[model samples]
Target: MDTRERYAAYAERIAGVSPSYAAWARSLDDGVVSVLDEVPESKRQPELLFAVARRLGADPADPGALRALVQEARPALLGALTSATVQANDPRRLAPVVPLFAALAARVGRPLGLVDAGAAAGLCSIPDRVTLDYVVGARSEVVRMHTASVEPGLHLVAEASGAVPTPAAEPIEVRARVALDPNPIDLAGPGAFDRLVEAVPPEATDRTALMREAARATLAAPPVRIRGTLPGDLDRALEALPDDVVPVVLTTGTLVYVPGADRQRFVDRVRERGVHWIALERTGILSGVAATLPDDVDPADPDAFATASLDGVALAVSDPFGVCVRWLADPNL
Candidate 1:
């Protein structure tokens, strides 16, 4: 698709998430996009451009303002777009997978050493640190996983389908928290935190608050951040985890950035280590897992739906951001 069509499609995708961005995408003319002529074709994404504009103190919805900002600070825009690895650090996505951690820990009879693969600042790595409420199906049967007795400062909710997986009777034990990213973000500082929050749609205050809460949790006890990417670096990451604990590697909404052909290689790497792999990746991202999904539910739009897999088997169909879930198999099985 051309630049015009790409923006139009992006507008549709974010209509609910960021009406301001949708409006910006729809209203921006050809002249606005021409500013990206010098950037690489792969880097000229709507969200990336909008994030760059916002981080640079400009309103992307206003074409005149965004264009002016880009013109005055072209180098900054180029640097941000080319090198930035901004992603949706939605901690809520862990609602469906948190229980699995408990189950795995119970099965192995050891504490878990979690390595967040492709983690952007390890935001989702704190699943065990938060209280997640899952309201199952349309009937709304609620399931709560309380990881701690202390009053949790962070509570997140997601609607789910199918039977909610029962966590172990005991609370989860996370002996080691580590994350692998090409550039690990340090959330203790203000600048990195602001840039991450700004990358979210400007008007979605609800999600913005969620991001803040998760950020605070991560900052209080940061993960052992490792500089790496998937497939090629999985071995090195696993080696860093404690030997006594069950190694749990999780990848959420990050596989799409991995070259399409290499996704299965990452899966194979996880399996070879005899580690538990929890993946909340775009639907059909890994052909082996997609092949196991029943046809009735397999064709859901990959942009909106994701396959939650454990140990290379698809367990549920979930919203990419963790708003909803539909379990298909027992994750611990």
Candidate 2:
């Protein structure tokens, strides 16, 4: 897709999620998109452009903010665009998968060895330590996985489907946590936590607050951060873990960053290692899993959002950030 089509599609993608972003994306005139052309196609994504502008002090919801930023801070914007990518490391992203993690943890009956393939700031790495709140049709309940060791942690609230309500399970133990990313956000470094918050749509004030809370919890016990990207770095990350853990690799919106073939390779490697793989990615990205999606879901439509799969089985389709989850198959319990 050209710059015009790309932004137009982005407008539709986030329309329901962020009205401000939707409006701003659709309002991008030729000149503004041309400024986006200055960066490579991958970096030209609406999220990157808008986020970079916001980081540079542009009002996020303002329709023509990018144009103004380009006029005032072109050099700084371009310099930032040279390296910055959208960081969807929101710890709240774990909400939808909280149930899936519970089922997996119960089945394994061992301490977890977590390897997050694209763990931006390692925020979502503490899956077992966080508290999960599931909103069913008419009732809301909390399912917590935290042991006595970790401090009060992330409280993830997600509306769930009727088929799979919150599970009552034993607390999951995290023996070792490792993260692999080409550029992992150093949450403890100067201004590092703010960088992660920049990706949250400016209209989302609630998420911003939750992010600050999550950051504090993550800083308390950060992951053993490694430097690498998906599929290629899975083994190296696994090798860093202790031998007693039930290894699990997590890929949340990370597969889209790699090529099509690498996606399959990553799945293959996970199976070969016999470690459980939990994927929350775009629908069609995984051919086998996509085929298993209910007929009503369409991989081509961004509105289908994302699919959450466990070990190649289609588990549920949910909001990209896991705010709303409709269980397709039982949590594999």
- Per-candidate Cα lDDT values, in order, are 0.76, 0.79
User: How well does candidate 2 match the true structure in TM-score terms?
Assistant: 0.89
Residues 1-333 of candidate 1: C-alpha lDDT, one tens digit per residue: 678887887778788888788887786655567666666764667777787778778875674666676568877777777876665588888877776676677788888899998787788887668776778766777778555433334687887667567744777777788989887888876587776776788788898888888887787667988898888988888889878888899988888778766777887777777888878887876888888887778444633378877777777887657777787866655
- Over the full model, what C-alpha lDDT does candidate 2 score relative to the true structure? 0.79
- Structural similarity to truth (TM-score) of each candidate: 0.88, 0.89
Q: Output the lDDT of residue 100, model 1.
A: 69
Best by lDDT: 2
Off by over 4 Å in 2: 35-41, 71-76, 138-149, 300-303
Worst 10 residues of 2 by lDDT: 140-149
Q: Write the per-residue lDDT of candidate 2 for residues 1-333, one digit (tens) a residue.
A: 688887888788788779888887887776677677887766887777888878788886677787787777878888998788778587767876666777888888888899988898888887776777676766465444323346757877777774673464576677898989988888889989778877778778888888877777778778999999768888999999999998899888888877778878888888898889888887787998988888988766553588988888888888666787778877745
